[model samples]
Target: MRDLLAITKAIADESRLRAVGLLDGRELCLCQIVEVLGLAPSTVSRHMAILGQARLVESRKQGRWAYFRLTEDDAPAEVHDALAMVLASLKRDKQAKADQKTLKAVLKIEPEELCRRQSDCKC
Candidate 1:
């Protein structure tokens, strides 16, 4: 019960929840996730670490990028299932919809373009 609470606390942040929700349909590179969330790499990585520690997300390194996804081992059957339901049940606001659309646009670009776009971005 305590562990479950801790996991919930970690994911309680809106940014983290958004990140988790995006993990629903596809695996995302750190760069992609950072762009989607419009957060500093370190900030995004920290949120991911919290999620990873809470068994709410999983990570793997590929070349120069760290990719994330919803993995089987990340959560128990019931917990994972519940989180999925919760994510689906939540209302996606106009801002969220717009953010998703922006993410999709950025995803269509090459990694080089992504890196270039993020080169000077502090957050």
Candidate 2:
């Protein structure tokens, strides 16, 4: 029950939902997500932390970089269900499509260069 409540709250915000949408089909550097969403690094980090708490995403640190991806098949059934709903909803969303376009461009930039472009990047 607590986990479900956390998942519900984690996905309640537009910014967070957009962040999740950006993460679909690939793992991304934290800075890459920040670029796609055009949000402050700190804000995106907090949003990701919430998603992590809900077990909707998993993250790891590699050197000075952090990368995030959707949880894998071993996740709870509720998590898989929630992810399916979000991904399906995003499929028809104009904003999500736009973000995907932006993400494509962002992915072209080297992660180090991308992180350098973010004013609030801690790495």
**lDDT per residue as tens, model 2, 1-123:** 998999999999999999899989899999999998889999999999999999999999999999999999988999999999999999999999999999989989999998889998977
List candidate 2 segments past 4 Å from native. Answer: none
The residue pairs found clashing in candidate 2 are none
- Writing each residue's lDDT as its tens digit, candidate 1 over 18-111 gives 8876777788887888888888888888899988877778899877778898756546765676567646744455555666787789779876
Q: After superposition, how far is residue 93 of candidate 1 from its true place, in Å?
A: 3.8
lDDT of 2 at 67: 95
> Could you tell me which 10 consecutive residues in candidate 1 have the lowest summed lDDT?
86-95
Question: Which candidate achieves the best lDDT against the true structure?
Answer: 2
RMSD of 2: 0.7
TM-score of each: 0.83, 0.98
Report RMSD for candidate 1.
2.8
